[model samples]
Target: MGIVIKQSIKNTIITFIGFGIGAVNTLFMYPYFLGEDYFGLSGYVLSAANILYPIMSFGIQNTLIKFFNENNKTEHELNSYITYMLLIPLVFIIPLTGLFYFNYDTIAAYESQKNPIIYSFVWVIPLIAIFMGYFEIFYAWLRAHMQSVFGSFVKEVFVRLLISVLLFGVYFKYITPLEFIYSLVFVYGMSLLLIVFYANKIKRIVLRFKVPKQSKAIWTYTIFIILSASIANMLLDIDKYMIKHYMDIDNIAFYSVAIFIAMVISVPSRAMHQITYPITAKLMSEQKWEELNELYKKTSITLQVIGGLILVGILVNINQLYLLLPKEYSQGLFVVFTIGLSKYFDLILGNNNAIIFNSKYYKAVLSLGIVLVLLIVLLNMYFIPHFGLNGAAFATLIAITLYSLAKLLFVVLRMKLFPFTYKTIVALGVVLISFFAFYYWDFSFHPMLNIICKSILVSIFYLGLCHVLKISSDINFVMRSIFNKVFKKQ
Candidate 1:
């Protein structure tokens, strides 16, 4: 737990800093520099590429982490395992590349009718997909070695920092919009090379032709995870994909701003999961059910409280946030609330997804994930045409809520592990009251100043109350540590 907390804090700091840069890129720079169509095109390309990333990697990113620490093997055996992980994805990626190549014209014809900007940049999708796949391949390599912080920093911070510089180049008229889009491919390609270099720098990877002795089990798990990855990608990326279909490509830019704002709440979970997944897998492998259950509840409570504060801040400040953005994007006001709450729901689940994915019941969860993807797609199809962007936000909110609840119930029923308590109820009550109290109260000042005041007051009140009530041991520990350090300095 000490190592987990230490590294999680490190990763969390890195991720939020990255998100800070991303918020600038997403809300201000991209909108101002690229304008809406190109901004949306960038979003569309990335979202579409994400949809293909799972297939390209063949789920090796997750499979590597799940199986890496299962047992110790000789260097020869480990090298053989590396060979399988590296080469197997190409068996899937290459053919998909070919499929995209041959069907390029037909696909472009359909997409251009809806958003012709997609036509010029359609090829970048497969290229970015391949880049993303390899990036994760190396990222998981470092993660399996329990060196996640550096890799996470590179992925979260370095990549966004690169994007910021490139967008500024576009702002200064040093590059055309089309070229700016192409530069993104270069950014991802460079990121991939750096991660690959870092992985080798950590431990020289040796790829061998021999397969592991558990080749049969490895293949089965890899296939299952491939399906799981596809399902997961669809849930996360389908909204942008569908938005492109139903509305102008520019709408994606607006939707993306709201989505990014909402997504800030999930940063803690995202940072924590990188370290927690391998730890969870190790615990499950050791059959330390008690420790695993304790980890589950602690994560749930800590994330719930933190996620609650972020949600409050975002929702209460959403108006001022949109004020900073162009008027065109201000339409996504409801989009932020719906999507933000959905993300909060995801946060409170903690590492439940990791727990389920690493457990023996993974296959069942994979089945449910498939159903979730289908539901999300269907919901988007149904809701977008009738309700517009808000409808898409509603679709996501519904799908994520139902999907998370289902996962929660499955874990409870099958493993007899419930990540809930009297504090869970109290935490919910605290969140609701905080939201209602500060939501209607505003100061007569500049919008930004008002946002700052409300955010500070809400955070202080909410966190102070949580501390007084002793809602979470993890939060209390963190706060006490801060106080101790402060008093020591005094």
Candidate 2:
């Protein structure tokens, strides 16, 4: 818990700074400078790259985290493991590169009919995907060593900062929009190099290139991770992919904006999970089920209390947020609500994903993930043409809700532990009451001013209730530290 909290706090600060830069890039720079079509084009290309990342990396990132600490192997054996992590992904990467090269024209012919810009730079997706794959691979390498802050900063902060500078270049006519788009590929490539450099700095990695004793199990885990990661990425990115197919790519820009707003709610979970995952793996290896269960409940309530506050903040002030965006993006109001709810629900599940994925029951969830992927694709296909962007959001909300519930149930039934308790109920009740209390309240001030005032008041009201009710010891610990500092100053 000490390491988890320490790194998570660091990760949280870095992630917030990253998202703040990203918000300016997404909400202000991209739309203002790139315009809707190019913004949508950027969104589509990145989403496409994200979908390709799972395939390119072959799940080496997850495999490394799960297996790295489970054994006390020799240096040679560890080197062997690292070599396999580096090499095995090429099994898919090489062939996919070849396939893209040979069939790019035919693929572009089909997609370019929808957006001809895609045909011109169709190769960028695979390029950026390959780069991001290595980025994650090295990031996992550092994370397994319990050194995640630098990697998180690189991933969440450095990349966005680069993008911000690049967007400014485009705005000042120092770079054309096409140049800006191509620079994105370069940015991802640079990120890979940076992570690789940092990873080597931490532990001068040597590749022994020998087979480890656990080769068979490592391969088995990698295969399942590949399947699971593919399914998960498909569920997350397919909406943007499908949106391009059904409507003009510009709609993807609007949808991306909404999704970004909703995704901020998941940052705390994302930050914490990066550190907690290996710990959960360690716990499972040690067969500490009781300790694991308690960790699970604590994470659930803490994330719920935090995510619930953000969710209410987003939902209550969504209209004011839209007012800040271009009028064309106003259609995404419901998109924010639905996707925000989905993310908050995911946060409430806490470390259930880490627990399940690290346990031997991981393959069961892989099976479930496959089903949900198929279901999400079908739902998106059926709904997007019918309800448009909002329909895609709805499809995601339903698929994710069902997927999370199934995982939670599996953990509960199989392990006899649940993430929810009386505190969970109280935290949710506070969220709803806070929403109703402040949502309809209006101000004569400017929209931005109104948003700020409402957000501060709601956070005060909601967090006050959670502290009073003792919803989470972690939350109280943080509050106590703050109060102690303030009173000591007085």
Candidate 3:
């Protein structure tokens, strides 16, 4: 647990650094520099690329991690195992490009525009897809070696940094919007190259065609994981794809802006999950069921607390937040809340997927992920036409909620594990009370001061309530330690 906390802290700092870098690009730079349609196109292109990423790579990313951890093979052997497993996906996907080539018109038909920008850009899809597949496998290698920071840095930091530069160039009228969108392929390719270079720094990274002693088990797991990974990604990416089909890139931009804000609430969960994956692998390897169960509870409590705070903060100041965006994008306010809530639910399910995936029931995670994929697509199809941006938000919310619930119920039903107690209930109560009190607070005078004062008031009131209930005594200790440190300085 100490290791989990420490590594998670490192990941937290990395995630925030990445988040800050991304916020600059997403919130200020891109929105300010790019027009709505272009901004929307950038968002849609990325959403499409990422949504396609998992399938293009198959389940090979997660498969690499699990297999590498299990076998403890040599450098060449490990590389061969993963490199070969990865080749199978390319084999099928590469040939299918010819098929996709013939159906290019059908693909562009969904793009809101019937032009070369949409049609020509279709070629980049496979490049982006192949880039993503390689990147994920390399990242999994780093992760398997307990090197999350490099992967985090490359994914969260370097890629965004490159994108930021592109946006800045556009801001100065040095590049056109269409060209900027096309630059995504290069940006991603460079990012992939960076990860490969960094992976070499930490360990040997090469593409040797050495044949691996194939195992039937590995192939089976990979197939299951591929199915799971593809669906999981579809659930995450379907909204961006659907919006472009149903509406225009303008709405995609609006909703993407809202999602960028909403994603802040889940950043910590993603960081923690990185640590949890390796730890779960370790625990399951040792058959430490007891510790795994306890981890489930503590991780859930801590993540939900942190996530709830960020969510509340975002929801409370949403109006002020949109004041930072363009006037047209201010309409995405409700989308922020819906997506933030979805992230909070994800926070509460911390390490749940890791636990299930690392355990004997790894296949079940895929089953649930597939179910949610269908749910998300159906929900988005139903909502986007009726409600527009809000509809997309609601669809994501429904999908993630069901996904989380399914994982939670699976853990409890099959494993007899639960992440609840009286303290959990009290903590949730505190969250509710704090949200209602602060969510509707009147904004007046200095906006920053009002935010600070109301947040402090909420903090004090919530802690007071917690002290009365003895909910999360860790919070009490944290407060006392902070005061002690501050007073000691005085």
Q: Which numbered prediction scores highest in lDDT against the true structure? A: 2
Off by over 4 Å in 1: none
TM-score, prediction 3? 0.91
lDDT of each: 0.88, 0.89, 0.77
Q: Residue pairs in steric clash, candidate 1?
A: none
**Tens digit of per-residue lDDT, candidate 3, span 76-138:** 786677568668677668777778789878866656452234555666777787788888887
**Candidate closer to the true structure by lDDT (higher is better), 2 or 3:** 2
lDDT score for candidate 2 against the true structure: 0.89
Displacement of the residue 304 alpha carbon in candidate 3, Å: 0.9
Candidate 3 worst ten-residue window by lDDT: 110-119
Candidate 3 structure lDDT: 0.77
lDDT of 1 by residue, 1-490 (tens): 8878888889899999999999889988999999999999999999999998888888998888888874247888778887788998999887888988999998888777888778978899889888999899888888778888988888899999999999999989899888989998998998999999999999788878987777787788889988988887878889999998889889999999989999899989988888888898889888999999999999999899988989988887888767777888898999988988888888888889888888888888887888888889999999999999999999989888888899999999999888988998899888998989888767888888998899999999999989999999988999999999999999
TM-score of each: 0.98, 0.98, 0.91
lDDT of 1: 0.88
RMSD values, in order shown: 1.2, 1.1, 2.8
